[model samples]
Each structure stands twice: as C-alpha cells, then as structure tokens.
Target chain A: MEEEAKAKPRNPSGPRLCCVCNTRRAALKRPKTLDQICRECFYEVFEEEIHQVIVENQLFSPGERIAIGASGGKGEHGLLSINLYFCSVEDSTVLAYVLSTLNRRHHYGLDLFLLSVDEGITGYRDDSLETVKRNEIQYGLPLKVVSYKDLYGWTMDEIVKMIGLKNNCTFCGVFRRQALDRGAAMLKVDKVATGHNADDIAETVLLNILRGDIARLGRCTAITTGEDGPIPRCKPFKHLFSKCISRFCSGVHQGFGKNKVVSSLTIRNCGLQKPRAILDIIKSGEDFRISTSTKMPEQGTCERCGYISSQAIDRATKVIIPGWKWCKACVLLEGLNKGLPKMGIGRSRGLNNDRKDAKGNDNAAKSIESKQCGTLDF
Target chain B: MQLTLEFGGGLELLCDSVKIHKVSVEPQNGAEMLTMKDLLTWVRTNLIKERPEMFMKGDTVRPGVLVLVNDCDWELSGQLNTTLEDKDVVVFISTLHGG
Candidate 1:
C-alpha cells in the first residue's frame, strides 16, 4: 500500500530503509528509541504500545462503555485555563481513531463514545467541537456534549465578562472537573479515557511539586484516577509522548507558553534533549511517599451533587445549605451565581460575609440557587 | 528556487492563518545552492506575521516543531543543512500544542 511513496525519487539525504522491516523508506525518527522507522511500522508500534498499556494496567474489562474526554485540556499545568486549545483537535481525533481501532482489533469489547465539555469559549471551543463532531461520524462513535450554560446557567464567556480574566481559569478548571463527570454519567459510561500523554503527566508532576501540592503530586502519575467517583478516568497515552500522538494524527500546533506559574515549554525542552526525562519524572513522582502525619484531604461525596469531593463543607456554606457539602464546582458556581465570584477560589476564605448576606438580606433567589450548580440537572 | 511550504497544527496561526505558501527564494551571499537554513531565514522574515519566537529558536525551528521535506521527516533529510530543490515541498508542524 505504501509502494507508491517508495517509488518517489529519493531526496538529497537519500532513503533510509526502515530499521525494523529493512523495507519501506523510514518516515520518522522516534523520540523514545531514536529509531528511524517507516510509516507502517511506526503506526503498528504506536498502537501496540498503547494496547499493551491498556492490557497491563487493566484499564478496561469486556463490554464496558468508555467515554473519551475529547478535550485537549487533560493533564495540563499552571495555566490550565486555556488548555482546551492545547492540541484540542488532533489529540482527541487520534484518540478516537486509535481507541476504536484497538477496540475492534483486540476485541476489547468496549463501547467507546466521545464526550466533550463545551466551556462556551466562543471561537476556541466552537472550532474544536466541530472537529469532534466530524470524528463522531468518521469513527462511527456516538458523541455527547455537555455545556457550561446548561449545567451552571453561565458560559465561560459570561464568566469572563463578570469576573474578568484575573481568575477565570480557576473558574474554568473547576467547572470542567464536574462537567466531564456529568457528561460521562449522561452517556452511562463505566470509565472515561483522556488523551493525556507522558509529557502532560510529567509537566503536571513538575507543576505540582513546584506548588507544593503533595496530594496531586502523588496521584498525578497514576494511569487511572477517581476510582471511587461515579466515573473513573484513565490515560491510555500516559506512556506515550505528545509528539508521537500528534504526529500519528498527522499535524501539530504550537502550544505557546501561557502558564505564568511555570513554563511547560522548558519541560518540553528537557524532553526534546532527553526523552527519557519524561518517564523519569513520572517515576520520581510515583515513588514519592507522603508521611502518615501529613493531612491529605479526605475524599467524600458532595452533598449537593453527590460527586466525590475532597473538600468538607465550611461552617458558613453549611449554614446556608444546612449540612449539605458542596464540591469545588458547586462552590465556584455558587460564587458566580451569588455574584461573590471568589467563594471557593484559591485559599479557603471565611464566608462570614456570605452568611451575613444570606441572613440580613434573606435573598431567597441567591441563597437558594444551589439548583443551578448540581450534576443532577442533567 | 521555488518551494511549497505548508503549516498545520497551529503554525498557520503564526503566518496570518494561511496554511500554504508558494514562494521563491534565492541563496544569500550568491551561494550556489539554497539550504533549509536560508529558507528558514526567508520564512521568518517574510511569512511569519506574529510571535516569531514561537516559530523559531536559534538558527532552526523551535524544538517541538516537526519539519518534513518532500513528505519525509526532516531528520531523514539533513534538517537545516538539507539543500532545497526546485518545487520541493517543505512542511513545518508545531507538535507543542495540546496533549
């Protein structure tokens, strides 16, 4: 099938026959092995390696429904707010292609669906959503889109308008956490698969370490997370590189350095010079042990939405909702809806003023607007 | 030398959102042949509309970008040292974006 490409006249560097097959012209130099391999061999090994990861990790069982978190926003560092555009179209498209192919070839018996969260970022999400829609038809997998407006009654565009860009990413990151879970639940999927590759995980490790986020630091390297939640998520590409995934899909776009917290570009530079550094970072992160005395946030269900949350209900919010625990998303939405906008962002603050507003004003509309934040609406 | 340049995966955004460009370039200093290094200088000066740093670092493209010449990975070729021929197709894709 690739004979036509072989027939083309050789360029100045000449045709290097594939190292693995000793036939067919080498098309790429792999970062992992530095092997010059042909297109066919590259595709085979790429798929096989991912298949191996799935099998070894036991990411799925037969007849389980899986949703691909078809957003480019997975496993991002610092400026996660705009990661929605981080290889948004290509990675998701490739994930859909490879997962569907593996499911059939390996008889994984998985019902795969593309689940996307529409943050309503106007030009950004609008374009990627179209690509995912195309992938739905191309892969013959069903797609379910959950939007911010439908869930929280406010789009990112509207949130930005009110809160401005100062802390909008905080709002975005928190919202997407719940949005993906809600989307998966709507599809009745057993697990969710994200296009998070080794590079993203490595960067996340470095980012978490830098910020002293010991909790996420420990869990960021896991192949799958949120096991106790309503829907768990896995990363099939966790062992893969971002370059291979984008190249497999046929193109790559520049992810400009946007995170002020840390430059992911610098980490990418390390990967380029030494590809093994990515895996090494993940290994180091995995080996990290938290002392017994260190208080890790306990995972419990959000009383409002019934989703898993690490945060306990604060006294102020408890007074308002009366013993109902609010998850991060609900807290952020409660802030947005109540016009406080800073309710659960950054460090936990005294909602003393919050209680005062609810008690003095007796604003039933604002205080009782918890209906706009829960996952049950879907 | 006449060359066909194509950008994708967001490099097109750097070049005024135009993905393909047909351009003619001449070797600087009256050199006998045009190499990719010269072509890159030409592209940086004439094509890229914004964020030149995103498109290039040092004398070559930024680390994460992939370069293909005549549909073959540039690494198979000589990369920046590879000489350009008439109507040769050179593709630059930035693999740095999402995931």
Candidate 2:
C-alpha cells in the first residue's frame, strides 16, 4: 500500500511470449495492473487440457466441490477467483472451486491468505483472525486454514530444529504433500489440484533420477493422480512449464501493478541445486530416447501409511502403516547421509528402457482402467 | 591382465580396491582361462562376505566398475562363458547417472 513498495524494478524486463503457447504475451512481463490476459490464456489452455483428462477419466463428478490448495502464492492464491472468473464465461458447472485449508507454517498470517487454523500459536491464529475479519468483507469465497503443528507433527521451525535447515525443506515438501491429501479428505472434496507446473515436474523428474530415485521418477508426470492415497490429486499445470508459469505471474503483476495484495513468499532453497548436475541425463534421454541403465527396484508399501514406500521390502508384510504417506522424497529425507540408494527409494523408474519396471503399485490400476479416458492417458 | 572395472553412483561402497576381486587362470599346456560368471562368483565369495556393504544385491553395474575380460560388461554375456585371452583387460568403472 506504500509508494516505495510499489516501485517497479529499474530497467525491469519487458513482457515475453507465454511459455505455454509462445505466441501470446507471457504473464511475467506485466505491471502491477490487470492486463493478465496472456496469463489467463495460458491458464485457460492448461485447464482445458486438464479438463480433458478429467472428462476422459471422469476424475471428477458434476456439482462436486473440489478444493484447490491455496498457498496465497501465485500457484494457489486467488485460484478460485481466477478460475471462477473464467468459468463464469464458459458456464461449466462440472466443477466448483472451494478454498481449502491453508498450511499455516510458522509465518501463519504473515503469508498472503485469510484462513487461519486453531494451532494455539498466538500470533499465527490472531493474524489469521485479522485476515478473516479483513477478507470476509471483500472476498466471498469460503476459506479453511490448516495449521503447521497439526498436519505435520511439527512446524517448519520445529522441523528445522529437529533436522537441520537443509533437511527441513524436505519436511515441508513431504508434509505439504501428505497434508494436502489429508486436508482434501477433511474438506470432503472429490479431488484436490495443486499449481505444480511442468518445470516443477520436469525439474523433479531430473532430480529424482540424478539421485537415482527410482520410485518418484515413475509418479511425477501424472496430471490427475498420485500413489495410493485417499484422495486423487490433479496438477492443472502438469504440461505448463516454468517459463510459461512465470510469464503468467508477471503479466498479472503488471496488470495489477498497484493491487493491494502481493506475493509475500520467503522460502527459497527448494532443493533445486541437486538437478543442476543432471542436465545431460535429461538432454540425452530427449536427444536419444535413451536412459542410463538402473537396477530393478523393489516396491513395497510403507508400514506406516500404506503409500508406496520402497523400504517395506516384503510386499505381504502387514504393518500398522502410519497415518502419513510420504513420497520417496520424504522417505529419502530421513537420513541425508545415506547417499543415492536411500534417497533413490520411491523415485521414478527410468533412465533406460521404455517400460519402467514398476517400483510402485499398479494393482488397482484396473479399477480405474475401465474408466480410463482414452484421449487423456497420462 | 589390466581389466578395468566400473560401478555407478554407489559403486564406491563396493570393494575398496577395484581389482581386489580379479582372478587368474592357466590354460592348456600351461595356458590360463577365466569367465564373467567366475568373476561375479568371485566377487560374491571374497568381497561380499568380508565387506557386505560394498555391493547391493541386484543393481545394474556401471562402466566405472567395469569387469572387462577384453573390455566390456561381462554381465552382458559370456559370464563364466567368456574365455579369458592373453593380456585380457577386465576393467571396472564407476559411472555417473546424470541427465
């Protein structure tokens, strides 16, 4: 709201073509004003293709209220409003957007959302309350905020204290994933969609294999699902790459250059540096359709949460799986010192050969197979 | 026999000395012979029991940990079947799995 805060960067970069189409203006080039069309177009195309997957797989049902994990970041903030704004013109009631609970990490109300959870953290809950009081008057959508202490056994800070900062990010990633699923079930929503785009997926794809992560490598590309968890998940931007997503973000920034709200993010080290060394692996696969040879991975569900955990070792070994279903990323984080093999568990299963030897479950695939969307196979 | 052996990623965890598992053979009328399966079995018997953490049960070996009877992945074929010729260089290497 201050003049100093709204100042644009000196010699700020001009707009570029949308990464999705490369023909339209990208979102990253916009002012703090409202000419967010280029971004809207990209979102429209991305969502349309996503909807195709939904229709083909019947991933959702008519009139079902689906929750979008709103981080108040570009990915989730204003998600319902933007998507609803588009739907208003298209008039498709096949799905309705409901604001799901936000994971109020230590920052709580400091982040951009108005939802608050009852986490006993005085400032966080109070900030969330203030946000609710402020946003309710202007925003009409329903909001549910989840707290850090609940979904995760510990908050980001607490996690960092338990496992050093370097390992804490993995805690956040793992918890965000598990929490999203748990929160979706609580909301009684049919599905949950997160704003993970192509760059995230592709970067993750490369990182998984670079670490020789066989389990996660197999599950990263889907637009509408994940390991055997309670609620099915969808990534609307599964095909949208980083350059495109950034353009959209920038366009919205330029258009609403003077908007009351701005992204207030702080976390920066997303464990992204690991993939830098593996660029040639992806390049080789793309240029040659060849992956380096890897081992035949063993797949087993976690004794803690039935999700695909490679450490379970014995398939029939029944154990009181915990309520949490961590991806290989989460499992690998437990011991940062274990090197590639430990980290490699629950990663994608490719580097060589077309058919990835199944390191995760494909058992119930037949349940959804009969309902598979012919045109939208992920 | 300067055979090069290579392993990938975690191959460093394998036997400390790459060549510690090599075997020598004498052929007909004082000739020597050996095979890939022989090498694998040798690795299993000598290294596996002494230092179990060195190798995984079934991971694909990298070129960095190569066991070239004449310079190739012995597991590719001709394991014990591979005939060791004179001056056969069984090389083992440790390869990276970067993209």
Candidate 3:
C-alpha cells in the first residue's frame, strides 16, 4: 500500500531528465554505464561511440571501398513509440545503415557497398534479401549478392532436404563463411564489416572456450581479423551491447530454434544483471594466453579450392578428399556432390573412416552453429 | 487503462506475427492503479500466443527484451514497479533474436 501510493502520475515532476541533455525525459538506461538519457542524446552518444571506435582503431582508410556484410538483420519494420524511431530490418541492416550514416556524417571518404550472401533458403533469405534490397536503394549503395547455388551448385533448401534439419546449420555456417568472402572478393572491396556486437563476441568467447578452440579463442576478441587473408573484417560494434544495438537498430524476426535459445541463455542472463560483463568476458578472452607448444593448426590454402583453410594435410595420400586438405566449405560441398552427405560434417582427421568422422563432426558443428545466428560463424 | 503494446525484433512472431495490440487492462483485485508488473501478467496471459519464454523470464521480460513506456525505457521509470496511466504506450522489443 505504501509503494502503491508512491506511484507517480504520467507527467509527474519526479521523472528523471536525460542525464546528458538535462531536458527531455530519459528514455533509455545505458547498459555499459547505466546512464539514463533521452532518445536524442542516446543516438548522439551511440553513433559517436561507434565513430570513436572506428577512428581509434582506424578501421578504414579514406577513399577505400568497404563492403558491409548486410544480412538485412536490423530494423526491418519496428518504430519507436515516438516518430523518431526508424523502421526495422535486421542486425546487418542496421550495420549497413549505421556504417553508411557514419561514413557520410563523418565524411570518412569511403565507398560503401552492401554485400549479402543468399544461402538459398527460400522463405528466409528471400524475405531478408528484400530488406537488403530496400537498404540498397535507401542508402544509395551498390548491392552484391553471392548465392550458394551459384558457387557450390546447391541451395540451403536443397542441402537441408538432402541432409535434413539436424546438421543443416553446419553446412550453412561453413558455406556462409566462404560465401561472404567470395562476395566481398567479387565486389573487390577493401574490407568487410560484420554486425557482431559485444554480446555476440562474448557469446563467441564462451562458445570457443567451451569448445576448446584455441585458434578462434585467440583471434575472436580482435576488433579486426584475417588481416593477412584476402579480405580483412572489422566489427565497429565490437564494444556496443546487443541490447542498445537492437533498441536503435531494430531486429529481424526469424525462427527462434531451440539451439539458439540455449546458447544465448547463459550470456543473455548474465548481461541482464551486469551489462559490462559482456565486454569483460571479451577482455578476458583477449587476455587469454595459449601456450605455444599446444600445436595449433597451421593456416594454409586448401589445396583443392585455394580458399584459406587450417585443415591438416593427408601425408599418406596426395589426393584431396573429404578428410583431406580442403576448406570446410569445399569439403561440405564435396560431401553433397559425392552423395556422401556425411563427409566434412565433423573432424577431418580420419582418412579411412569418413562416416565416423562425419558423425562426430556433425555434432560438433551443430553445437557451434547453435551458438551462432545468421551468417555469423566462428 | 488503454495501452498500446508493440512488439518487434522478432517478438512479434510469438504473438501470431501481429506487431501491435491495443487493449484495456484494469488492475486486478480491485486495486486503484495498475503497474507494469500487472500489465505483463495480463499481456502474457492474453497476447502472447506462443513461446512465452521468449517474451518473459520469471516475472519481468527475458533479459534481452527492452521495455519502453510512452517512448521512455521502463528501467528509467522503475521497471516492473513503474505505474501505468491511461493511454500509455508500452513497447517490447527482443534483441535476443537475429544476427
């Protein structure tokens, strides 16, 4: 009864003002600092924060062409209660919009292109691609889409039909990694920027550590990765929380499968209690030191497709097979093409037993995929 | 109270793909005023047709769900304890979904 009596009216003078502007009603509580601020101030700080990250990290060089890995995963159709809110598309959608906006507003002198990978999921990719198309026109940026069917002679729909939904994400995830790179190569862009936020990175840090993937664990926390490869990738949102990102950027409506739910649950729950914990986890991951004698996989080009691969070579036989020296994407494609859908599904160590290797790796990739969303793969 | 409820960021999928709902909610047990905690119970029972876990965890929204009242964040106004007035617009957007 005491608390009920204290409930103030809608426009009571008790409501706090924006901490930054000291005028408008504070609309959001900042996750990192717990700063309650108005919408206008939030946008200002959010964009400026990202811009600062870009400048501080030198994510780009002026006049260089950068490809935004836009998956139409941002504000597709959601509007804030006030008219100031932009319509939603999805995460990568917001990545594209925000990057382009920052580029222009800051005069970064960058030629931005929206690069999308069409995994051939009819109902899913088609709809999101439409959002990306809208972003193409809306942002005045050229769009390039590379499809699995074109590159690998298979659509995800066909792949799922062949392999079923069980290990489907593995095939999709492996193929998607290559698809984005190939798409960026096609665009001839200098770099690829993904929409991986702080939460995503933190989730990845946990996933990699749990999986004991020392290689990815070492590199996952970097703001930019694969600098030595053909295309480098940067995450301007490496510091921003998904909560804040989704609030302003909006999110895509997709299947909330059980795997995604379970994987995100731990970090998501932790995030609710302490927003800074996400960044701290990433920091811990970065500070993690793997012993040099651990025999890390040496990076090498897949002898078969020339894509970057860390797969060990088959010394006994020079032949490149499902369990041989080929990129994961190519190996999965070989499995599909060879009518042995199990090939490259798991560990590539056993050359004599493809089926057993496939079964083991299938579960492995499935667990990895469960933690990943959309085109983001470790 | 006549409140407008909007769901986005894939939260709409749980509620039959309908993004917005306008409903009348009265405080239960003849209480004089309504609070967000009460509205959430009502919305969970009435609006969310599937996967209630995606929308709510325990009593408040799932950790990733952002709640805004009249274009202001619920956290600023006191979260679940925030009092709701007539014609208030409460929006729930899930950042958990999507890439």
On a 0 to 1 TM-score scale, where does candidate 1 land against the true structure? Answer: 0.86
After superposition, the stretches of candidate 2 with alpha carbons farther than 4 Å from their true spots are A1-58, A71-140, A246-378, B1-99
In model 2, what lDDT does residue A18 have? 48
| Native contact fraction per model | 0.38, 0.00, 0.33
Using DockQ as the measure, name the better of candidate 1 and candidate 2. Answer: 1
In model 3 chain B, where is the ten-residue run with the lowest total lDDT? Answer: B90-99
Per DockQ, the best of the predicted structures is: 3
Write down the TM-score for model 3. 0.85
> For residues A24-54, could you state the per-residue lDDT of candidate 3 as single tens digits?
7666889999988877788889889999999
Candidate 3, Cα interface RMSD: 10.0
Instruction: Name the regions of candidate 3 deviating beyond 4 angstroms.
Output: A1-13, A72-89, A250-263, A309-324, A348-378
Cα lDDT, all candidates: 0.73, 0.36, 0.71
DockQ comparison, 2 vs 3, better candidate: 3
Q: List pairs with backbone clashes in candidate 1.
A: A86-B98, A87-B98, A253-B9
Q: Which candidate, 2 or 3, would have the higher TM-score against the true structure?
A: 3
